[model samples]
Target: MERAMGISHFGAAAAACVFMLAQGARAEEAGPHLAIELNAVAPAETGCLISFMARNGHPAAIERAVFETVLIDRAGQVERLTLFDFGDLPAGRPRVRQFSIPGLACDDLGQILINGTSACEAGTLGEAACAEGLDLSSRTDVELIG
Candidate 1:
């Protein structure tokens, strides 16, 4: 009877170890591996345009990518813009996207805040998993805030 009790405890311990290791593996597979570089360029006409680049650094493919951006001016005025949704980005590839802001000029911009990301997914990283892993940078004078 004592021998049977020892075997039961050993089995339980082994099961717990396996469960922990499995969880760790899953976590390792899920993470954000995307980098963003943005620049505000002045057009010949009169307004400003935003140039964006999205690069995937992970081995797995990114299925969907979307971001919510808030543009703040020097006078504390705010304008919200939704970046173009880039779908299906292969690993190690960089995608370029650009858009024009009708009347906002490059100098008028004060700060750009990335409010949130949605529809972000990768092979192992689930939907919206890449939001926290983004490394954002800008070439313009305006500050890129979060």
Candidate 2:
């Protein structure tokens, strides 16, 4: 009987620990949040491709992300290009989206801009929970401006 009681006590303690762990994860997803970053950029056959890494700093998941970029030529002609939308960007994960801009080369790229995000609806976090948090890194010949 004593052994049976001890076993039950141990089982209860383990269950408590599991519950606490689950709660902690939920809390992290609920706290003040929103973060994303651009890790690299590469030139595609048509235009360019940008890689974005989502850090677990946002309370909501990003379904689709949109960005607008500006390109300049040697003759000082400015052009606007919209990158492809990234889908299902979860926290602490990375996603890549490509854009098609004809006749654009690496050297002609002046700057890249992050216009904003759509379909980034806020979940149970709150109305003010969704935020734009991104970091930019360079892997190509152009400069990125977010």
Candidate 3:
């Protein structure tokens, strides 16, 4: 039993290392390159626990967006969930950020738009590629990475 448990832990660790290394290759970042780290993604609940940080490729202190914890009920219904509104983000322009969620194979964020402006937090990260009527507080749909 002891040997089996050790093997399991070792295998898990190895798998995690490999996965992280693999992800290192395909991180779509924008100009100046802000290190994007996913806090936590829960597709099963149609939400994610996200935290922002600034990166300079060599470990520099940076600022990022303040996202509120979006919640999803067991019934799989989406209401207007607000985490942060027009908060600051880290360096560089905004680009696609990957997430992990279960049961959400794929869903369109539909441009996190508002009105008259497509700049959710333009002052900080410059203009982003989102619609003007998109609700950044809502999770349109996400895909489960499993």
Candidate 4:
């Protein structure tokens, strides 16, 4: 009787472990979110050039996405507010967009904030869907926030 109980407990534990692994796999497969990464920053003739790599993990394509972006100075003060239009992001594909801020130096810039979505045009998906599960990352010293 003792040996039978041990085997039964071992089987139940194995089943639970398998179940958890399956759930994790499903979550990875169903990547229902957007990922935005700050690829690079360079100095342009006009000013500071900012490059962003955006990946749409949603099932549908986005016609247009406009984000309310705020540039923060090194002292953590708000520098400027502007609208960055990321046009036509295909589903599961990555897109790169560059913006040049006139009269701003790359070193002086501290952080970039995605205040909110100014506009999002996705078929059957509302504007709020653009920011749904939005993830931000940066490769440079400047921070990227949502």
lDDT of 2 by residue, 1-146 (tens): 99999999999999999999999997665664544455555678776555555544554565544444455554556766454455555655545544456666756666665555434434554333334334455555555555
> Ten consecutive residues with minimal summed lDDT in candidate 4?
26-35
- Pairwise lDDT winner, candidates 2 and 3: 2
Candidates in descending lDDT order: 4, 1, 2, 3
Runs in model 1 deviating more than 4 A are 1-32, 44-46
Highest lDDT: give the candidate number: 4
Per-prediction RMSD in angstroms?
A: 11.6, 10.6, 11.9, 5.7
lDDT, each prediction:
0.75, 0.56, 0.37, 0.92
Clashes of each: 0, 5, 16, 0
Query: For each candidate, what TM-score against the reference?
Result: 0.66, 0.53, 0.28, 0.80
lDDT of 4: 0.92
The true-versus-predicted C-alpha distance at residue 136 of model 2, in Å, is 3.1
**In model 1, what lDDT does residue 23 have?**
93
Off by over 4 Å in 4: 1-31
TM-score order, best first, reads: 4, 1, 2, 3
TM-score of the candidate numbered 3? 0.28
